[model samples]
Target: MEGGRWDMLEWLGPDASISVFNYLDNPADLARVGAVSKSWRKFVISNQFGKRLCMTLCPEISNFTHIQLWKRYSHQNASPSTSMDWQILERAHIAYTYFAHCFLSCDSDKDCIMTCIGASSTDRFPVESIHNTLVPTDMDHMVYWRSSYWSSAGQADPNVQESLIYHLKRGLYLVNEIRIRPFKAFFQVGDPIYSAKHVRFRMGHSKF
Candidate 1:
């Protein structure tokens, strides 16, 4: 009503309003926009604008068909009048808001690995230590990272699993993709490649 303070949503049609909101890639900006009015808040949450922005910025998670609230008992505290559908949308809104912010807040241009915590199993103490994985590239043809790659202890059963933990450069990071190149034992006779059939990643805080 006053100078420069008018509800744009009131003047613009739905399509135009959506087109305008589409340009906002920043999570903070989106949050501020939603706070402008109750209608704007509903529009942002109901349409999953945060999720759309996150997928647009991080293509790796674009395949996500659904998202659930991480805190299981959070729903128990909700008011009785809050419908399940609205609760779901609200969960998505909160989750995606933080998710997008995690991605945007970090400096994606640099390496995020700060240090290796430990591996579930290492073939050798120093030679095949999980620390070797930190090396970006091979140093010399003969000797590199003391052995050039990390190796897990031979497992009796193929079903056995191994894992490596690392401290990230920042406490919060959105790891959308991981690239792993299996180690090739060039010095060996057959030059066999050692790799896992599949790999998985997890993130969390370290216990003191």
Candidate 2:
């Protein structure tokens, strides 16, 4: 009976429901929960879901910093998306949360030397452009690279493989998430933005 009652998520109340939701580590799980009901969807969108993910993954991501980030970017000039777009907000929160969590986790271990493994894209607009695009940066302005080759950059075409490989400088590190930002084409005067339909990452000590 207790288990059945608990399963009635609506009974959890706004506060309790949020507490329960916060326990979820997977971003996809969070998104799925919102689809369960209209109330849940509202609750998920209103709450700083991304911030919660970061806090759960790495407690060091202080509430202050997270709040400031929300205050600044949460309402700023969203180039690719509208400022009020919930999906965009969720995406930003998740990405930043991961970035912060990784940064803090790396710092936690004194012995861990967090160094950037050079990234090599299958093809770039110019040689070595990958270096500038993928480097770790502050919360504001994530670096991005646009593929120069039209053939390789086409979206939803599996035949076009735009691969990016990052070789770490020999150290054990815990990787939680990677953020990939598609160019908004904000540079050109009202050009359409292009993004990959699918993305995959592989990490292990082995030769494929």
Best by TM-score: 1
For model 1, residues 21-127, the per-residue Cα lDDT tens digits are 99998999989988887788989988889988988877776776876555652546578898889888888787778778877765444467888889888888877
**Clash counts for the predictions, in order:** 0, 0
TM-score (C-alpha) between model 2 and the true structure = 0.34
The lowest-lDDT stretch of 10 consecutive residues in candidate 2 is: 146-155
What TM-score do all the candidates reach, one by one? Answer: 0.61, 0.34
Q: Between which residue pairs do clashes occur in model 1?
A: none
lDDT value, candidate 2, whole model: 0.53
Q: Which 10 successive residues of model 1 have the least lDDT summed?
A: 137-146
Q: What is the C-alpha lDDT of each candidate?
A: 0.76, 0.53
